[model samples]
Target: MKNRILSIDVLRGITICLMIVVNTPGSWSYVYAPLKHSEWHGCTPTDLVFPSFLFVVGLSMSISLKKLNRDNHRKIRNKLLKRGAVIFLIGLLLNWFPFYQTNIADLRIFGVLQRIALAFMLAGIVITLIQNTRSLILSLIALLLTHWSLLYFLGGTTPYDLESNISGTIDIWLLGSNHVYSGFGIPFDPEGLLGTLSSAAQVILGYLIGKNTLKHGKPGTKELNHLAVVSLSLIAVSLVWNFVYPINKPLWTGSYTLYTSGIITGFWAILIWVIDIGKKEKWTLPFKVFGQNPLASYVLSIIVVKLFIYVFKINGTTLYGWSFKHLFQRIFENHLASFMYALAFTFIIWLFAFWLYKKGKVIKI
Candidate 1:
């Protein structure tokens, strides 16, 4: 195995923590604006978390494949398939966890990890099989353009609109309305199958960028300069694309891919410079712990929260609400208490991650 890069681990760890914070709110109604996702048409800080995690998946895949014997192509391909399937399975189980809700028709099929699984699988196959850089770039372009065209032509009457888009239509048709997420007061699955195509493009883009980083082999001034130039160009292009397509995270628009990828590219560079190069890494442990076992951390966090809110209750009130009502909400205003609960939960999970980190256990799937 190749020596892992501290910067990638640190960057991914940052997203892992942010994801926990955003998802485990004391109350959805009490979230700070930045923590909340944009209603429909724009990007927010919370929007960055999912894409950034996907980008790390692509980067991590590239890193792993780079260490393998190139002549052993069959082995590499099989490993990719297994990893994707395992991750998908974990997501599926989490969606239907507790086993009490046995109604198969109502279980959510597309979710964060499910999307990660699909995107990583598609990205891995395309990036691995098409070794030619030019061909891979072309494939990436084809995916984005095709998705855009389909959204415009095939989406029912108001294609980009919330209720009538091609995404909601296709998912409701394929998965049945009962399976699609109804959280938004409509039948729309954010992590739906159709969006996987564009989402895969983001992963592919990360793989290509990561391949370049590997080619450079070490983080340095040269790496920082090139990344900055590339990021700026991408951001400019995304800004122009925004006028036409708009940067929508739920839809995972091509422009959103470009915009977030560009922003994170620069952010990744900074982390590389600060943590790996400058030797100023005294405070990077918590995030690195999260990165080491990101999927495990996320799955466990969700399960714990779900149990507290749904399955395990105290005196007929959910442990989740009961804590907020008596401990947090009773002390502070409702919103601040809600926010504190999220932070406390995040800290609790961090302790779990820290123990895993100390034990030197990194759960890959």
Candidate 2:
């Protein structure tokens, strides 16, 4: 078997880096358009991050599941179930962590890790059930179409307004009132239940793409060309789909899936061309380290930042108060300064990831 692709690791690491950059902005209002999620009915560069992350999970599964085939089916299923449950629970715990400030009784039940866990479990079971590429492709198509049908035909009782879409209504009914994202001033979450089906499909699409890339023995110019062709085809299809469905992340619309998946495929194709085929080494070292220990870096980054802000009270204020973010805002008081603060914060997190890499300590799930 071919060893793990360094390019894939770098790609995953880059996605995680973008995730941190977007999520930990110094001031949300001043962020660049590419780093911001779309306000309503379209996909943005930032909208691609979550789907790209899930796609990487699928790419990883293509490798991991192949190894697990040596074991009995029951054992594999048990392991998948247990691992998925544990990851999902960890996500729930993170949501409620430092549980004093917020109401712990009804914390957000759905989050990044929870979505990952569910997508992994569902996609894993499907892969196990149907052991061929054609089946996987068919399943993905079925999921996307079914999800589209559900959302379109099962229009909300309140009408198909922008604010009261079918996805939000379903989430509100299923998740109850207390657990939805209030940031939108409505009972909806971009990572809601109905949208998860399409998210799982996104992962499956990644798995299919990964299987194709790996089927060729080595990364070659011909393979890169083929990848480019596939990427272009997906992008064309996604554009066509977007007209009818609208690329809305909140709804997790089918068009949104196609659009993000196209972008993700295009991104990996370029990375494979540059890093794998071109044999570029120098620029990728930091990303490779981050990729090697992504989950650990992500969780630790959040916890460490929160802890620092909580513990190091500076001048009757938190460490975050003394942060470049606040300092820049106080001095410049403009969007540009806010943008710089975000970049600095991102750099700091990267340094932390690099430090862990130097120690050769990677945390895995």
CA-lDDT, candidates in order = 0.86, 0.78
Cα shift from native, residue 231, model 1 (Å): 1.3
| Candidate 2 collision pairs | none
| TM-score per model over all chains | 0.96, 0.92
Poorly placed runs, candidate 2 (over 4 Å): 68-71, 157-162, 308-316, 330-333
Q: What lDDT score goes with residue 138 in model 1?
A: 96
Candidate 2's residue-wise lDDT over 276-320, tens digit each?
Answer: 888887999878877987887677666756765666677877776
- The deviation in Å at residue 181 for candidate 2 is 0.9
Clashes within 3 Å, all models in order = 0, 0
lDDT of 1 by residue, 1-365 (tens): 15688899999999999999999888877888999999998989899999999888877766777754557766777788788989898888889887785477688888998999999888877876776778988998998998888888987667788877898889988989988888789989989988888899989888878878777677688878888987898889999999888889888888998999999888998888898789778799889899888988999898998899779889999999888888988788877888889889999999999999999998765
Q: Looking at model 1, which ten-residue stretch has the lowest summed lDDT?
A: 65-74
